[model samples]
Target: MREISLDRLRTLVAIADLGSFAEAARALNLAPPTVSLHIADLEARVGGALLSRSRGRITPTAVGETLVERARRLLVDAQQALDDVQRQVQGLAGRVRVGASTGVIAQLLPQALERLGQRHPGIDVQVAVLTSQETLLQLAAGTLDIGLIALPQLPVKGLDIHPWRRDPVMAFLPARWEPPAVVTPAWLADQPLILNDSSTRLSRLTAEWFASDGQQPTPRIQLNYNDAIKSLVAAGYGATLLPHEASTPLPDARISMHALAPPLWRQLGIVHRAGDSARATAHVLDVLWEQGVE
Candidate 1:
């Protein structure tokens, strides 16, 4: 079957609304002959007269009125489809996929997402909670739009990475512990230590710190969640090394933070596809840029 032309449908609607071919031609910036040809061709295709001549105006015949009604709805739908595509291309509305580690999601993303909603209610943020390494993997795979990761992560090409923040890695000890002036590896080695699990970058960093002093830490327990370690440390189970920002509000009031002798830190950075500057992503970056990243 031959599909109807959108141009012809539009012409039909204009002619019917204006009540004359000459008037529609003027409104559409087309010659009257072109307008009359449009109507004549439409009538021939339908195998019936489509308009009736009044004293000085025109009216649609029964079939023509039916065609005009359908034409109006069809034209509206076509225009709507165009607008939706444009919005997606412009990032004016759509879902932005974001990947972040547990620490960032817990402490930072809540406020960021809240501000994002207030400013651009049309853009939705989809969050995935992954470790820093995992977050970087997803970002490189193109499954993530933005990634918030703990550094120093191994660098990868095709990614735009920039430092977001850095916080001191401190010794978390029981609130009433001697409150040492500076926590040295010697003191940490002697204590039953609760450290992050070996799989994480923070764990590796802490291990390197201990290794620097010719000491190998024998952790009483290794766990991934900072809060859990903070809780154990607060109960006097052991001292722990954790980023100050990651274990905020101090999971337990009984836990106190002290700096390392030489001061260790966990750095955070943001990652995204190198060439991706999506509107929603850009807007989110704008809000974050003002956050004093680095």
Candidate 2:
């Protein structure tokens, strides 16, 4: 026996309500023969007559009555399911798992999320703090839906990546020191540099920037957190290089920001699985694009 067709079930309901094959056909936008065919198919499948025709009146058999009632409930459920998925596609609801660096999570994501919450409240964003390389790894492992990572990275296979923004690398020095308006890599190399530690892409980029000038500036101290590095810099521990957004110079004006000569920019970008179709993920990416790197 075959599964009962929804069309046939609907035709059964229409026929029973209209009390005539011709009338049901007209209501269903089908021919009288088509309506009769639907009833015949249904009766054969259920091994019973579904309608009794008497003097132009069509009364439904017990089987027809029971199935038509169930069909109405099923149709309602099916429509509800459709509506739910449609909302999901519109980016109104879903969950997005994100992985990003500390700098982005601290300075950028909070601002983006503020607007995101106002605009897409149904979309829940979950974040995990990770470095650029770790984010890429998680994206590949399918543990992350999207990633905010440093650009010019070694390409990860099967990932869709694009540059989002480039923030100028700035040097934060102690308040007492009056550095030049435009600091050069050579000049920065000579200072008691506080590097961002080798665990981060920033560390490699800064090191390469110094190396490009045929200079190897050794860091007086290495710290991972930007706040900690700034605290140390404020106390005259050493100067630090960071993306402009990462520098928090307020509350204690002990650090000053200076532009870099031949200004180096820390390129940041968003990455996701190729052909990602998650609506929440796309919505977040769109928000990031519209929001830019604030």
Candidate 3:
């Protein structure tokens, strides 16, 4: 079958709406012959007469009405597609896929996303909670546009990871427990601990901090989500180690925050493809950079 031309389809729809070839030609800025040829070409492609002229009035034949209705929908979709592309080209709109841990997403991403929405309301940021290793894999595979990953990662190919934030790891103990002014590994090791899951970088970092002083105490329970761990600590489950942002409000008053003796830091980095990013992605990256600490 012969492929139909959008231009001819447009001409047919215009003629049917105006009920005259001359009016359609005038409306479309085409000559009378060009309008006639468009209808003729369309008829040949479909093997049917598309228009009827009787008693000085023109109207679409049955086939023409069907084609015109469908063409109207097609034209609408085409115009929308063009508009979307144009918005992207103008750097005024796009969708950005972002990956980060549950903690960062809960605590930090909201501030950055709020700034992004104010600055570029047309840009949409879709965030996924992922582990650092999973985030790195997705970034390398070109699935994620931006990544907020834990630092101290082995370099992955085609990815550009830069340190973004460093927060001091603190001990979160139940308020009911008599906590030390500064929590040391020896002090924390003896307490029943509610800790991060073994998969997380924060878990490894805290483990290393404990191991440095030869204290390899086991945790009572391990979890991935920061808020859940904090809730457990508040419930007097056990003491836990977590990074704290100065500006973030503590979820519960029942949990006491204490600094680690040999202060351990939780580091985070942003990752993207090693080249210039799309404008929307750059906008999000700028907001994320603003969230970073020295």
Candidate 4:
């Protein structure tokens, strides 16, 4: 029996995760025919079919499922081994994959990465901007070295979350619209709102706060990008509620921010797999924690 090469194992794992040969090929930067050939060769070596294809969906056979589980562990171990060697020779030279929610990516990660790059020029940082839930999922899957996300009221399983910063939520008002001296939830609800889309954790938390108060502001518009929302408010489209980071330095002279009466705040943090043994990941976490404190 021939041993499975790391490249072939990675191809198999990607196919299983993505559920299609074409997608797996794209991910690995290999032609679709090459992906198919690798899988066929692996199946021959293993003496059984690995995937069952029908209706544009590929399902793993029992043996395929078992192989996938083992392959994932093997791949992680292989990467970790490489990381260990790279650290000794080059001192934090390997790439670190990080995931973060849209808010953190916009407000926090840029400065943090700038400082990290200054300290460790050899380390390469790759970032993925995703929703909070998607960030958590990617972190758990070992695809991301770390995740920056909003702290939900409840904790997630199989992850270690460290509180990094607390940012106050602020109300965005059009430049022409004079906001109340002290904005309350009730007062803010009375205005036409340009709100964050419901897909975000901030939006959900804001919605829950409104639900608790038995008030629902009819949205004049819903948007996901903080910068775009700010631009719209500046254009006199509508007011929005956002974290202080997003509301600060009003791009247009007409826009202003007022603190909420109750002073709502959101906690942001660094999260990672509960017991990641990779030293590079640990170093990157330390760098983030240090930058976050500044």
Candidate 5:
């Protein structure tokens, strides 16, 4: 047997409410013949007479009452589901999955999210800590909605990348060391350094900076977490190179920060799928861009 359509269900519900085929047709903006055909088709499919004429008034039979009750709930649920989708399309409410480096997440993303929450309280941003390379991979794989990645990266197909921020990479030294006002690559290279792991783009950037001065001294240790690197630097383990976001607080009193003599900068970019973005994702992208320099 063919299944009954929502239109027939609606016609039944309307007739049960209005108690006349002509009244239901008028209310539904359907012709009288269409209304009669709908009831006939629905009864044929369900194998039951759905209406009764009693004392010149039309009313539902037992089967019709049960079907109408269930149909009402289904119609209400379907309408609600459409409304939720419309809200997401309007950027009024939805979840956005975003990927970024731990450093950026720690320093930059919080402020951006805070502002986003204020402007769009209904939007929930889900943040993931990922490397620049990992972030690009996630965005390409359709697992992520947005990415904040290190710059100077090779292009990835099917992704759109936009330069977002350029913050000077600074040398973080133990305060007790009495370092120079501006740290040259040679000066930092000669010290015991806590550096990002060789696999990271920042590590490559820092390594290139050192090589420009013909210096490539080995680090005391390599680590991927920036906050952990800072903690080690504070313990007087060694000095390190890291980007210092303008809005972030300076390191603890035990650590001192100085600009690179040659002015090395850690560039960052925003990435997303290369097409029209979902409204919620677009709203998040706007908030992230607001945190960076124009």
Candidate 6:
């Protein structure tokens, strides 16, 4: 009996899932003949045919089905073992992958990451700019170590969430449309509005706020990008509502921010995989919280 290689098992699994040698080969970026050779070698070692082939479709035989089941478990164990070894050797030297919403990253992460680099020079940090919803999904999928996101109304299962900061939502008014007194939602709504798209949590919240008040403010323009919305508002195209942190002081002097009287606030938080036992992730979280507090 010969030892089976991990690559051979992976190829087998890929072929089984894809159901064709050519498809599996394309998926694995290998030639079709190489995939056939791997399966053949595995069958020779097992002393039984593992696949039934007809007209280019491939289905696993009885033994092939059994081996495929075991192969999946073996592959998972192998990956866990590799992660363990890398965790031990690198300790905190490898990459710490993080995801954050654009608003959070713009307001928070850059300074935190800079300070973290000063402290732990060995650890590499990679950040993916993602929406709040996308950040949560990526964290759940183990693609990200940490995510900075808006606080959800309901707690997300299988994640540790830490409340970080609460920023008040403010109205961005064009210089020409400045009101003599405090801004009212109804008054603000009457002007041409540049609003965030429906896909964003912020947009949803804003929509609900208007609906609850029985007010329907037709947006003159709908935009998804924060910068674009801000630019349009500053150019006197329309007024917008956004978190105070998301609104930067414009050098053009056309954009002015006013605090809402009733005070709508967006809570920001740091989310991580629940019970994740990675030191690099912990360190990054610490740096994030420290920077947020300052």
Worst 10 residues of 3 by lDDT: 244-253
Error of 1 at 198 (Å): 3.3
Candidate 3 on 43-136: residue-level lDDT in tens?
A: 8888899999977768999998999999999999999999998887677899999999999999999999999999899999999999999998
Instruction: For residues 1-294, write the lDDT of model 6, one tens digit per residue.
Output: 579999899999998998988889999999888998999899999999999987778989999999999999999999998986686455545678888766667667777888888877767889888888888888788888888887774577898888877777878888777574766666776778899888777888777666666778989998877777888988889988888754334424788888775567777888888998777777788888876631
Task: Kindly list the per-residue Cα lDDT of model 4 for residues 203-251, writing each as its tens digit.
Answer: 8878876776678888888877888888888888888888875422445
Model 3 residue 223 CA deviation in Å: 0.9
lDDT of 2: 0.84
Q: What are the clashing pairs of model 4?
A: 175-254
Q: What TM-score, to 2 decimals, does candidate 6 have?
A: 0.66
Task: List candidate 6 stretches off by more than 4 Å.
Answer: 1-91, 246-252
Order the numbered candidates by TM-score, best leading: 3, 5, 1, 2, 4, 6
Off by over 4 Å in 1: 1-9, 12-78, 81-94, 153-155, 176-179, 190-192, 218-221, 231-238, 246-251
Please give the lDDT score at residue 144 for candidate 3: 94
Model 1 steric clash pairs: none
Error of 1 at 43 (Å): 8.3
What does each candidate score in C-alpha RMSD? 4.1, 5.7, 2.0, 15.4, 2.4, 13.2
Better of 1 and 4 by lDDT: 1
What residue runs in model 2 are displaced by over 4 Å at the alpha carbon? 1-90, 246-252
Model 4 misses residue 29 by how many Å?
41
Over 4 Å off in model 4, which ranges?
1-84, 88-90, 246-251
Taking the tens digit of each residue's C-alpha lDDT, what string does model 5 give over 1-294? 566788998999999999999999999999999999999998888889999999987899999899899989887888899998999999999999999988999999999999998989999899898998899998899999999998878899999999999998999999999777778987888899999997788999999999999998899999989999999999999999999988999889999988887888989999999995699999999989899973
TM-score (all chains, Cα) for each model:
0.74, 0.68, 0.92, 0.66, 0.89, 0.66
Question: Residue 276 in model 5: shift from native, Å?
Answer: 1.2
In the range 1-294, model 1's lDDT, one tens digit per residue, is 577788888888988899988888888898888888888788879999888989988888899999999999999999999987678678787778888766667767777777878888888889987888788889889998888887766679999888888888888898888855878887788888999898778998898898888889789899887767777898899999887764246557788878898789888888888988678888777666555344
Tens digits of per-residue lDDT, candidate 2, 201-236, equal 899888888888888877888877887887898899
Q: Please identify which of the two predictions, 1 or 5, would achieve the higher TM-score against the true structure.
A: 5
| Candidate scoring better on TM-score of 1 and 2 | 1
